[model samples]
Target chain A: GIQVEQSPPDLILQEGANSTLRCNFSDSVNNLQWFHQNPWGQLINLFYIPSGTKQNGRLSATTVATERYSLLYISSSQTTDSGVYFCAVENIDQAGTALIFGKGTTLSVSS
Target chain B: DTAVSQTPKYLVTQMGNDKSIKCEQNLGHDTMYWYKQDSKKFLKIMFSYNNKELIINETVPNRFSPKSPDKAHLNLHINSLELGDSAVYFCASSQVNPANTGELFFGEGSRLTVL
Candidate 1:
């Protein structure tokens, strides 16, 4: 089983601020995804970057597969961004199977 | 439209009871999974089904059984529920492709409280 570790287990920021969250895996992965669990407990897929970079709205993510790490950035955050961010990975050996998730990073944004 | 949906968004039961949660995905995905999120928010995979066949069972208790009646539905049944089983359970679905495993779409979690 591949190990996924997320940094800054807890975060608090004022609205309109910027922040970055990181995820480090223990092995090469064929599938890497970032998810945001809103206050209502719905897990929303933020990114599916096994490698490279992508951006959507105020969110962006970069994955360095070779380095076994990924970073998620949020610029000018809003109260809606307050929730838990999760990093999930499927190791190469997993071969399209279930993804292993890291302990999430809880984010609180106050306006 | 909701890509994935789970019924009985909240369940509260007593010990020794048996309950079931139903999940359905309309994304036409080939794989579906069940994950448990504990109080500390640690998410762990409990079971995965590929094309309605059991593919991964992560040492989950025998009391926990998952059934996929078809490619679009996977249901979880838990018997003799204990307090430890109290947690939020999520249902997710994804397309399993060699080139890229598509992003998993998850349903609003089902919160189970075993008293």
Candidate 2:
């Protein structure tokens, strides 16, 4: 089984600030995704980046498949951004297309 | 319209009780999954179905059974639930693409509380 570890287990930032979250996987992955679990317990898909970089408004993500790591960036964060950010990956060795998720980085953006 | 939807957003039951959570996805995806998130907010895949066929079954107990009557629906039934079973259950769906494994879209979680 592949292991997914997210850094900065917890983060707090003032509104309008910028932050970065990191995820490291123990093995090569065929699929990688970023998700945001809002305070309402809704898991929203942020990005699906397996090996490249992509930006979605104030949120962007980059995955270095060779390095087995990914970075998620949030710029000019707003108070509504408070929640947990998760990084999930599907290992190449995995039998099915199930994703193994990281513990997640809890983010708090205060206005 | 919701891409993925689960019934009974919240459930409260006593230990040993049996309950069922229903999931449906209108995204026309071929794969559906059930995930559990514990109090620590750690998410883990429990089961996955591709085109109404069981594809991935983790080390989940037999008490937890998942049924996919069709590709668009997957239901989870828990029998003799224990206190430890209390957690948020999420239903997700994705389309398998040749270019890469599909990205998962999760529904608003169903929070279960076992007394």
Candidate with top TM-score is 1
DockQ of each: 0.91, 0.85
| Residue A47 in candidate 2, Cα distance off native in Å | 0.3
lDDT of 2 at A3: 94
Task: Summing lDDT over every window of 10 consecutive residues in candidate 1 chain B, give the lowest-scoring window.
Answer: B95-104
lDDT of 2 by residue, B15-107 (tens): 999999999999888899999999999999999998898888989999999999999999999999999999999999998744345789998
Q: Per-prediction fnat values?
A: 0.97, 0.89
| Model number 1 iRMSD | 0.8
Q: Worst ten-residue run, lDDT, model 2 chain A?
A: A90-99
Top candidate on DockQ is 1
How do the residues A29-79 of candidate 1 rate in per-residue lDDT, one tens digit apiece? 988999999998889999999999999999999999999999999999999
Q: What is the lDDT of residue A54 in candidate 2?
A: 99
Off by over 4 Å in 2: B97-101
| Model 2 per-residue lDDT at B64 | 99
Tell me the TM-score that candidate 2 gets on chain A alone. 0.97
Name the lDDT value of residue A40 in candidate 1. Answer: 89
* Residue clash pairs of candidate 1: none
| Candidate 2 lDDT by residue in tens digits, A1-111 | 899999999999999999999999999998899999999888999999989999999999999999999999999999999999999999887735699999999999998
